[model samples]
Target: MVNERDPDAGTEHWLDLGPDPDLDSDPRHPGGWRWWSLLVAAMAVAALLLTQNQRATHPLPGTDPAGASVTRSASVAARPLPESHSPPRRTGSPLSGQSLSGMLFGASPAPTAVEPAGAQASAVSVTDLGHPLLAVPAGWELFGQGPGIVVRIELGRGRVTRTSVPEVGSASPIFFVVGHDRAIVHPMDSVPGYVVRDGKPATQLPPALDQAASALPGPDPWHLWAETETGTATALSLLTLDGRPAGVQVPIPKDATVQASDRAGNVLMFGIGGMYDLRQDGMHRITGGTLLAVGPTRWLTLECDESYRCDSVVIDRATGARQTVKASLDAYEQNAGAISPDGRTAALLQPNGIGASTVHLLDLSTGADRLTGVTTSSDQTLGGRTFVWSPDSRWLFVTNGAGRVLAIDRAGRAISLDVHVGAIDQLALRTTRR
Candidate 1:
């Protein structure tokens, strides 16, 4: 009835219910709803902050979804290096720039030095010792050291027992090959072939092999290839580790000198008849030259012209394929190339004719050669130097003319060992598996 005709008529209806309940309240002050809204906003902010802290404490398990690889990489960079069975790197003086690339004369700066051996440098360099001897590899021990022959026998736990050979002298340096537990000895003079184990005579070879001129490691870890002279001609005899004959005797020329025996026990010999394969009893009548290398799949021979400069011919034993490689010749000697164990790289010596010998590295696949600037401190002789390949084919151990032992890599980088193993007339590696 109050709002029947006027706009103020409905005002009393609303005003009558409230009755100015907050009339005593300040007009500038916020009400209860405003305070409640602020309290709710504070609680929400606290919940958001707690969720962020929890994520920081426990990250996701797998890859990061935030694309923060750079930050994660920093954490991994603090870890240690992995373990390997390689020789410790050396931190001695840097090498001189001595690598020559035929077309390029000057040497390049040497590679950065590796970490020092530190606490693990157990390889004692014994230059002061009077015994002219070589130590076994890292895990083996020198079983014996003597005037002409040194023997190394492996102990069970990667150790070795060293012993000396009797009746061997410097007058006739012993030529031998090491097997599993035994070594076959062939004295360059009148001594007969004998098998020695732990420094004692295990047994003697058959009468046919008594005149063995050379013995090579082969057939297996327990067999050796004895290049014997049968008075009338030369023959190849396969002998067991204990000196017993193991295979059919293959006959070679009387003057044939065995250069190398392949992994399959195939013998490569060179003589007045050129190159010959004793395994197949066939002659490689390519040219009269000296065999320089014998690889797993190939054999390298060098033929010289009137100037004494030589050409290297690599022949594939299986396929009879031949590849001729040309490089700077040393013009001084007959045999100097060494085919790596992996058959990928070759180390050649270009004797300077005076006394210093320049060494070079050749890539088998590309025929590219690099001068390693490695020099032997003596005149290049027919024998007395040593160039042996490491089991892994990554290193070459060379006994220079100056009598210093050096361990060189395929890149021609060298590390000199402070030891004198004497004039290595005949050298053999300790080939036992560790």
Candidate 2:
């Protein structure tokens, strides 16, 4: 009802329901409504916050992150691994210097020493023996008792112990000649090839005896040019020991030299021109003039049945069997041959060539332990004169037709001597290998 103000300016309005009601007593006041609304809104906010916190604390199942590896907290399934492909090592081979590597390793192995059949005994000194028999290698080489004497096979010569060769032309006929070690002294074509045991002048043989002594094929093998009045000189017998038979007759061409007896008698003579091996009781025909003694074994004058270059054969002594093996000379040298004490190797003795005459040895599969030369000398005669090994394999006696008696100790060194008598036809060392 009052004067109307400008329309742009609105008039403030306030309504008063009651004059001064006690606000604490009032239940439905405008202020009350506002306070109730705030309380309800704050409670709603708190509830919503709690729900969000719970969700953030833990994510729901069935949801996994991308690119996660499958990690195993425990052991994995059994399967072949590349690292396990290695072979298990041998117990002995590991420490045998075979080049095996592992965290756990051991020591190297030792060699096997296979000695001959005799009961092991200490050897005797050469000085103890009276007669100035040829000296020899000591130890396992030769066993001595009354002295290392080459017992004379003939009763007449048996009493003659002194190795003193009579004056040249004195006519003390010498039926036996031996080369002590590599030294040769004998009465052959008679030129007096007498070398003493002390390197002194023993005596002299006739020119014929000298010629015969000098004619020996030095260190290579027994090469007797083959001359005979009967049967075309079929076989050349070896005279190893003083007491041995003249020698085993090695049949020529039709009957080859099958068994080579030692020059001194019986030392080592087996499997030469041998037949039948691998298969039992077998036999083969040996060519005539086909077999000849080379060195330890037989050197073939003829080729194998197949016409191959073969020189080695294994003989079954009981069955008289033979088996021919074709291989290089070195093969024989390393396996079959035993090196002499003086240092001359069987290999050096026999070089492969046309018309080569040589001597060789063939030990059973036991393998060869070669002897190394002590001194440096090329002359086979000066070094190893092919001292024959005794059948007993116990002694190594030296024979130089000149009469310097030498002995060999299979376990020690070879000794030199100044003594003599009839030239040694051949000599042998005793065998221990049974």
Candidate 3:
């Protein structure tokens, strides 16, 4: 029997057990089983205390058994790192360094070279002829020639057609394409002009143009202005392509010279004092400046001092509004410029002092000026080389004095034609016949 205390009853009770032989033999140690029981109770109490100490050191997550995140203490809050300071990485576009306007207008950054299918034999120095970037316009023919040969280029197809005109001889010829298969050809001297059809002289021009000193095309394609001088008197007579008189002869100032003409048949003349505008009604003197180029509505002129230092200005014909364009310091007497057909852009050639001219483009609307990354060894004189624009106003074709031509766009991208003639004195875009 085991003795247990019932505290509620305040009495002693006995736990009954069966007799055991081992309990009887262990007389030396009385109540030994009770001692074993006390030792086991001490071990159990130690284990419980150890478990509670571990829980206090490593507390449970802040969440109460649900997934909701509990608020942390202020000392344990998180913070963002500082912002980085680095330049942006560059892109791989060929036009990387170009202006937004250039890119928007189809200028490529990388240099592109396109060699026409049989162009190996006529290939000149690649250094002089820049790479080809864009395709030429369709149905356009570029005409020029060397001694005894007329060179015609079908730019759209990159085709070169040569016609042998023995009449050209060794002298420089002044020619203009009148029809797809015919042109008006004359020696630069006092020789009478003739019409050439398919590389052969077809017929002589009318007697009225026999003593014409010079011929200028346009105001329109169907009409021409023939300058004829008799003794000390000089007159400009308008004529049709077939050599018939279109208008009466208009007397010109002896000392004044024609600078440019527009599609509206208005002739701009410059003399010692100032500039004059000649229309069908009468002649009127306008602003005083050296005229550079003329568009449908605007005109470009240069005002220079005695030292030849000059400033460029764009004048509006209707409102007479003047807007000064930024020009290079090197733009002096030797510089030449032309405005686009749309009157939105202007190309200026500044002599580089080493027999080369650098091309510059100006935006008339915003007064933005930029380099075209193009240089030419052409003569910068008004009568030596030509700067002719495409009818669409998208491309500008210029001669390189060496008989080759370079085409440039408003975006400043340029392409050199793979052609070589002796000396290209004149360049004219083929116009449509009426």
Candidate 4:
């Protein structure tokens, strides 16, 4: 009945209901006890844990948190805040009374700043290859005589190397006699004139009225001349090493002295006999005669006797201008002169009016240069003819025209033992001749 809800149209069935009270019944019920006992046990356990923690240890000084203590930890260690109190401004005139506090006690040492080993940075350095090792630097192994006709000893790494000079244009089968390394046969011009390398002829020009009284091998940039007869009065001549005809040939009156082809590709003809004019290259009536390499980029014209020998005239190759560039020696002649492969330096001959010879180098950079005595005389009959400049520039091999191949330094000092000329460690060059 209690489970039924009153309504004008009532419903009866109900389920899942709790007991409902009625006013007319009497009953007795028992209550569960001892609930407070569990609570008391919990409090006792917490108290024991607190006591153990406190008695365990009192951490030495700073080890314990600033104010983190058994009792006052919350008040002392809890983050301390900045005060709103402002400092008092300074006033002038004072009877300076700085009060001292009670007996100052011990204080903790300030932490060391530990000055940083200020970071050190690194640096760089590079050797400039200027003048051919012109003065042996240090640490160079001389393999052998460099490029030429017979076997030329090479001095360099891998495939890049330097060797001996092969006989280019000559009479007979003048070879690179292992003995005659520095000496070139007196007359390089052929009678029926043809350019020959090794024993073979490379090019041939008709015989001319006049052949160079003497010949000088080219500088680094080789300067060459050939005289071939076009007819009786006029002869065909060229300034280049290879071409069907010379780049240019101007008419000459039967005789001309010095002929030169500069790097600019211009042909020049001049004579230093007694009184002369530039017979070619349009440099008409220029004084002085024999042209010699005076600098890396300059040439020298020496005023000599009718034989055409004098102090060399140095001219700048770039502008084809003239300046007297003299070697320290009083008198000398060029059996051979070479501009260093480095192009920044050069090698030359300082001949003793007799047979001995010396070597020198012209430094293009500092304008400072030097000369060193390289050899005594070389007779192919006795020795041979050839002296090759080492590619490193540090040494020059007095290898040819002498019985022995000696190594001379840039300053003209003897560095290596003299090696007899041979094929042991040399490069072979075969000049083409027909």
Candidate 5:
């Protein structure tokens, strides 16, 4: 039977039943299914808006889905990761800008090449010699007089050590033969000498050499020849560094003073008698010229004219070969020159003017002379300044009257020491043994 139904009365109940045909066709009210779909769509829209709001409030550390930078909120503080979980920071050369992840993968560049052994050493210049040890007289004691003091200067460290000599009085001339670890101060007087070792307190030499009238260095550093006189008889007594007699005694001319000796035991002496050469066989007088400097196979002799003008000649002891040293305009005294250890060169100081001398190098082979461009000044009280060549003959060490020491190389490069001692009486270098 067709019955009249109120539309609003059963609207709420329509959710439980299927669509009514009359209501669906009447078009007066929308279908219940249509109304329910509208409600579902509204709820989904609300949920999506809530999710979008949350993402904008707190963004991630990286870029967003739109490929734009997303900054995090200041309200939400970040926490540091644990050390074990953190990435390593890049440092040092060749990898300063590299990342840990890049290094772990195969993205790193090739490493730099290492230098070869001695390649860095080869970069050092030829003039660079590590600081050398130099010694100078500490006091103004007369050269031939009483006890002498020595001041050792470590050129690199600026350290100074003073060593005093004892027992040998000032009546004789004091001489020094310095070595790497030891230094001997022997006075020409008839008294005991002193030996200084490694900067320690000097000890007296052996009593056996107490009677030595004069002493000269032997062919080696470990030995020396002492001239001893016993009741009008003069002899050369060989003694070791420790003062023990070498058991070799050769009678020499009376009043003869030993000048220089070579490694072959040949001795050169000069005195009131004349210049004499003491060989293993016997003594022979050297005439016509005065011996200046002696080496292993060669010797220098000086001949002066009536006006005291001198000429130097190098003589070969083996074959008597002679070569005249190239003449210089400046006057050169006999005492102002020395022979190199290799016997191939002679270092001479030619007086340039008052209180000044110019250093010249004379080639023993070709007799050629050249200026070293080094000028030394003296106070004139010391008579003249002396210089010594390094055992290798690569350098010459000289001192000025002002107490400044200079090291001049073969190339004319000069370096001054940074110390001032005030009036150096004597100078010596503690050089390596050749």
Candidate 6:
């Protein structure tokens, strides 16, 4: 009886733990079923979204991965390279096959191959620097004089620029010593000298020397060599426009005078005794003759024999060696001449025992003489002197008493140049770039 009574009580307790049958239809229980359903749908949706996100971030096998595309873009960016900016070599020049960096930083231009002593020079084209324009090469200029003024002639671009010296007189005979971009002009008169640069105004050069003669550009481009006479003694002086001497002055003999000088710093001295080399230490006696011209390493002297015939001697400055060759010239009239720029030939004007004179070309290396067809009077002057050798030693520009300008080459052919103005008073060659 006791066991049967406990079974019903147990059933009641179990039913109480479950949902209330009557409360299921209540208003508060309305949202309870739908809330569980909505939770289950949201769980399914979250699972779908997570699957799509994983597929986007990482590809499946056998398909291209996102990282692979990224790698391909990186590879394409590294494909191209840039070009170099070096200069090309200059072929066939004296500076052949040289680079710009080598020339600018560490390398020097190769030395130009020189021809043999007796070898004939190749032909060169000649251009006259006459009046009106005074046309010249691009790097060449007439620094010595201007038209009625102390001026500088800038030649380039097929045009001529005559820069007048506004500070000096119109009639001044201006002589200049030029360097890289600088120039110093001495008026060769009582006026003081002046300094000028590429883009600057003219300024005075201090401590001018009186009666300076036989002036060459310089011991160097920046210095000047001049012969100034003080009382009885003629001094072989060296000075710069800035009042500084490159070296000490060398005193010449009392009666000795500077006859001829060259750009190579060799001075020819002639006095009652003979010729002397005015060195910085003292005077070195050279020869006994009238000094004619000075070359790079040789001095041309005219020594006469008993027959009144003069013989030209080429004296080596370093060895004191002499090569005496008879010059076929009228020794009484045209006794002076100049050596070729190459130091291989000598040109003299020989009179044919008449009033007419011929140009005698002597090859000093081979001692061979060739006569040119050019003829002028014995009294004629070439640029107020005898003759001028071209800087290349290839031709000679000659002037006659008729005021005709002729360019005679090695083949003895004379080419006449047009001279619209008067006779040429002075002539100079621009041998190097400024």
The estimated TM-scores of all candidates read 0.54, 0.30, 0.58, 0.39, 0.54, 0.50
10 residues in a row with least lDDT, candidate 3: 119-128
Off by over 4 Å in 5: 1-148, 152-160, 165-172, 179-181, 190-193, 260-267, 271-274, 279-287, 303-311, 328-330, 351-358, 371-385, 420-423, 428-434
lDDT of 4 by residue, 1-434 (tens): 23666586686656655654432333332121223554565567556756655544554454443324333111111111111111123332121232111112224333332222421111111112223322343323333222222222222211112222322333322212111122122233443222322222112322231243322222212333333445565432443333234355555556664343232223345444422322245445434554443323445445657774555455455576755444442344532454443445555566666666666666544445676655545422111234445454555565434434566666656653423444322211112112
The sequence of per-residue lDDT tens digits that candidate 6 reaches over residues 295-383 is 66666677777787677677886788888765533352332466776888766666677776777677776657777877765232211
Clashes of each: 6, 97, 3, 55, 4, 0
Model 3 lDDT, full chain set: 0.59
lDDT of 3 by residue, 345-383 (tens): 877776678977777777877768778877666554423
Give the distance in Å from residue 273's predicted Cα in candidate 6 to where it truly belongs.
1.7
What TM-score does structure 1 among the candidates reach?
A: 0.54
What is the Å distance of residue 104 in model 6 from its true position? 69
Q: TM-score order of candidates, best first?
A: 3, 5, 1, 6, 4, 2
Q: Which runs in model 6 stand beyond 4 Å of their true positions? A: 1-214, 228-234, 241-243, 304-310, 330-335, 349-360, 366-387, 397-406, 416-422
Residue 280, model 6: lDDT of 64
Q: What residue runs in model 2 are displaced by over 4 Å at the alpha carbon?
A: 1-307, 323-327, 330-362, 367-369, 374-386, 398-434
User: Candidate 6 — worst ten consecutive residues by lDDT sum?
Assistant: 77-86
The per-prediction CA RMSD against the true structure, in angstroms, equals 28.4, 36.7, 34.0, 33.4, 28.8, 29.5
lDDT of 5: 0.56
Write the residue-wise lDDT of candidate 1 on 31-97 in tens digits. 6555667677666756675776667566676634343443311221111112221125644322223
- Candidate that would win on lDDT: 3
Ranking by lDDT: 3, 5, 1, 6, 4, 2
Evaluation by lDDT, superior candidate among 4 and 6 = 6
Worst 10 residues of 2 by lDDT: 139-148
